[model samples]
Target: MTKMMKAVVKSKKAKGAELQEVPVPECGAQEVLIKVKATSICGTDVHIYAWDEWSQSRVKPPYIFGHEFSGEVVETGDLVHNIQVGDHVSAETHIVCGHCAQCMTGNAHICQETQIIGVDRDGCFAEYISLPAQNIWKNDPSLSWDRASVQEPLGNAVHTVLAGEVSGKTVAVIGCGPIGLMAVSVAKASGASRIFAFDLNDYRLNLAEKMGATDTIHSMHADPLEVVRKETNNAGVDVVCEMSGHPVAMDQGFKMVTNGGRVSILSLPVRPVEIDVTNDIVFKGVTVQGITGRKMFQTWQQTAGLLSSGQVDVDPIITHHFDLADFEKGFNLMLKGECGKVVLHP
Candidate 1:
């Protein structure tokens, strides 16, 4: 009899998720099967559960959804090398086609034929998940699974925070969501002199404070640009890391940036956002970088070093944890903004 594993399955056009027994996936020639240890609820997961427009447009139904995770390899395919069974690991969720123009030019992170694990295919919201061995990143056994699970998002933070010059600079993170919150730690650990975190939610703003944000601005009462100007002594922040995806916040990030400053945007704005391109970029000479997935192994190396060195701690950000069976509860917690990073154990 074939081995079966419990999985969080989303039926076609399904509204929510369900736990079911499914066949453990067999490995492909260059694949490795990982025993999932921990997974995190991402904003993308929330979008999938809600079946929003992006989900409808991109995600085909009858697919299991989850991506941010860490695990231990339990098996490997014949062609798999470098990764061995029982190796502790985390994975880059972006599966890029190596032959694409972007890949051939050494920019594989944005390969035109990228297949996202949780979105484009089945993912790690199960007992086991198979991934191409090239995407696997071995985690040091010294790190806990919860910390390991964070590497994916941490990579995003690393990519954004390190996109341009940040050392000895003042940085304003325009959102305090999980990734935005993670950016605070990344900025602080990367030698930013002062880190300002802005958010509507006091809860997330508070978490940002603990994550190394020197100043927290509640965007409800005061204009973030005013606060940033005042805080920076009439000058704006040296760098603005925009993660809110909100049009207004994006504007504020530009307004709060000093002339010639760098603005790294990781936010995925649904509708087209209007920017004062002529004034913000052309006139001010500001450098606006659109940050996407991690810079492949480059971001992973920085994230792992940060985690391994204990320079940036995520233990405080992980405010809640739940078993895989309690995914709903975890999802609800994330919905209410009741916590920072929430983990699920399978």
Candidate 2:
């Protein structure tokens, strides 16, 4: 008989999920089976849980849906090498075709044929998961499971904040979600002269300060563009890391970024956002980059170095924890935006 495990599954094409017993995934020839230790809720996971328009368009039901996790290798397939059973690991999540044009050019994160672990196949929400060996990221033995699980998103933060030259530059992070909070620290670690964080949530703003935001703006109460402009002597910020998918925030980021500066957007807007291309891009001479997942091994290497060297600390951002069975409580916190990163143990 096949082994079974409990997992949070999007068992239907509707809002909400079910924690059910399902057959444990089998390890493929080039894959490894992991005993999940900790997994964290991401905004993407929340979208899938709510069955929003994006989820409806992209996600198929009756599948396990979580990607950010850390685990111990319990078994490995015959073709798997280097990584052995008992290895502590987290996964990169984005599995790419090595022969794709993007992959051939060191852009595997955006490969033409990319299959995300949770979104494209079975994921680590269960007690065990089978993942391709190439996706497995060996963790530092000393890193806590909570922190290890977050490396995936943290890499997103690192890639966005470090996409351009941030050293000795002023940066404005226009969002205080988990990734934005992580960017605050990444900016600080990268030697930003000053860092400003904007968010409607006072809770997250406070958390941003702890994560090394030189200043925090409550977007609901204050105007971020006006405030950042005044604070920067009316020239505007040198770099804008737009992590909020809100159209208003995106507009504010474009408006607050100085002419000829860089803007790195990591957010996914649910709907179309209008911006004056002539003013926001063409005339201003601003460099705009649409950032996606971590930059394959480059971003992963940086993530590991930053985490292991103690240059970045994600412990403060992990605000809540729950067993997989109590996922609803965790989802409730996420829905209200009252928590930072919520970790789940299977």
Candidate 3:
């Protein structure tokens, strides 16, 4: 008889998820079965819940649908090594093909054959999940499950904020979503002399200040470009971390970046965005980089160090928690933009 567990399943081709009993996933030869302790909602999860264009194009239904989580190893497959049952762990959501060109060239995060756990396969919004052994990241025993689960998105923040030279520089983070808010702390930790955070949500802007943003701009009421320029004596910011997929935010970031400065973008715009390529890039000599997932293990290492050293604290960013059965409440908070990171216990 198959053991059954409660999970949030995208069982239909429409909006929302259903919490139901499903068979526990089995560990593969090189995988480990984890007893999920805690999980968090991400922007990606919200997209799936809403059945948006991206989700319609990418997500196939009748699958479990969460990726950010921390758990304890309850079982290991025949070929698994080094990791034992009882190990506390989190996972790298991007599962990459080792033989791909990007993987061979130290850019596996953008590998041609990469599949995400929640999007491409069964995921961890359940009582248990089976994941590849190589994707498991052992957690510090003292780390709370909520914080441990967030390391995945934090890696995205670290990769974007630290990709450019930030030490002794001024930075403008043009988004206050979870990753954008995390960028504020990452910038301060990495020695950005001054940090300006922009967002339409007052809740998130206030949280950004707590995360070490030197200044916060409520984009709905104020002009971020003008404010950032005036704040920097009209020189503009030395770096721009574009974390909002909104076209306006993208334009604001490009407009506020200093000539010859760097712009690192981690956001995924829903549609084409108009920008003056000649003025924003060619003439200004601005360096633009499109950032994706964490750099295989490199960004993970940096994320761990930042957390362990107390340099970047995510405590304030995690504003809500719920049990697996009450997942809708968490999703409602997410839809309202009233929450930061919402953690769920299975």
Candidate 4:
């Protein structure tokens, strides 16, 4: 195996990711080395490239930053089990402390001691990445590497869509980014009666429609709440999946959910927003769930099942592709909303 690998490294405070040669990561005693086949740029990566407040505060430089990916196992540790070299796979990005209180209570997804692969450690935007063997997930050969790499975000969509019963329920996804668009597909596959998508980007709104949204609202030109209310007889949607972390969008999400409905918040609001808690949650009887990462292995299995069954088709969301050398261009496209899920091959 080569001792060095090509990777995109954020070596210092910068405005773009730099393509650099870095040493290939080796497997730990309980980890595995994966030969990455494909990886996708995420919103967090965009933040990292821009050196935004969140990125500056959380991400240290000289680290590789990407979490959504899939690859083949090239090496395994002594204590690893049930995995073989050449097996197609994707692993959970969150490396949770198995001894944490949350983990002991069957809520590893919220382990306070969690360290994300790409965010807190080296990620897969390179030729190879090493991860805890227990974090690895075997993939069905029928799944494409590009699609497999997306399971990380796709699992987030699944977690939101399935937090409540979507079967035959009208759903509205606020913020039609990649994850919101994925939620539209998941809601439809899970038997939603209708799916309404809201987004500021026309390109993303169009992609949402293609991904099975029954209606698309270009929030830049329309009042999303008005449109969704009209569509749902002004009763609001049965479920609201908020993927855009914009405060205004989050406010609209609360207003768009029907009385007694559930609002699954998958977006992270950067600041505290004013809201009438009594009116929004108490009076409306809204159940708000603050979503984190994937539900560890459970979400992964369900996401894989959805992919393997061909129920959630996400091909429409992959609008651009590039080799590792053009990562800046890829991130720029994402920032401009010119692409959906951009795939990068190393």
Give the CA lDDT, 0 to 100, for residue 280 in model 2. Answer: 83
117-218: candidate 2 lDDT, tens digit per residue: 889888888999998899888998888899999999999999999999999999999989999999999999999999999999999999999999999999
- The lDDT values for all models are 0.89, 0.93, 0.93, 0.89
Each candidate: how many clashes?
Answer: 0, 0, 0, 0
RMSD of each: 1.3, 0.8, 0.9, 1.3
**Residues 1-346 of candidate 3: C-alpha lDDT, one tens digit per residue:** 9999999999999999999999999889999999999999998899899988888989899999999999999999999988999999999999999988888999889999999989999888999999889999999879988899999999999999989789999999998999999999999999999999999899999999999999999987888877987899999999999988899889888888999999999987867899888898889899999998899899999999999999999999999999999999999999899999999999
What local lDDT score does residue 321 receive in model 3, on the 0 to 100 scale?
92
Candidate 1: tens digits of C-alpha lDDT, residues 1-346: 9999988877767557788888899999999999999999887787788776667788887867899999999899999879999999999999998998999988999999999998999988898999999999999998999999988988999999999988999999998989999999999999999999999999999899999999998998788878887788888889999998889999888878898999999987767898888887788889989888998899999999898788989899998899998888988887787889989999
lDDT of 3 at 339: 91
Query: Which 10 residues in a row give candidate 2 its minimum summed lDDT?
Result: 220-229
Residue 314 deviation, candidate 3, in Å?
0.8
Encode model 4's per-residue lDDT on 1-346: one tens digit a residue. Answer: 5599899998898677778998898788898999999999988888888888778888888889889888999999998878988899998888888998899998999999999887889998899999988888899887889899899999999999998888989998998889889999999999999998888888898899899988888888888888877888889999999898898888888888899999998886666777678888899989989888888788988998898899998799988889988888899898898889999999
What candidate 2 gets wrong by more than 4 Å, as runs, is none
Clashing pairs in 3: none
Sort order, TM-score high to low:
2, 3, 4, 1
Q: What would the TM-score be for candidate 2 when compared with the true structure?
A: 0.99
* Weakest 10 consecutive residues of candidate 3 by summed lDDT: 220-229
Rate residue 207 of model 4 by lDDT: 92
The whole-model C-alpha lDDT of candidate 3 against the native structure comes to 0.93
How much is 181 displaced in model 1, in angstroms? Answer: 1.1
Clashes of 4: 0
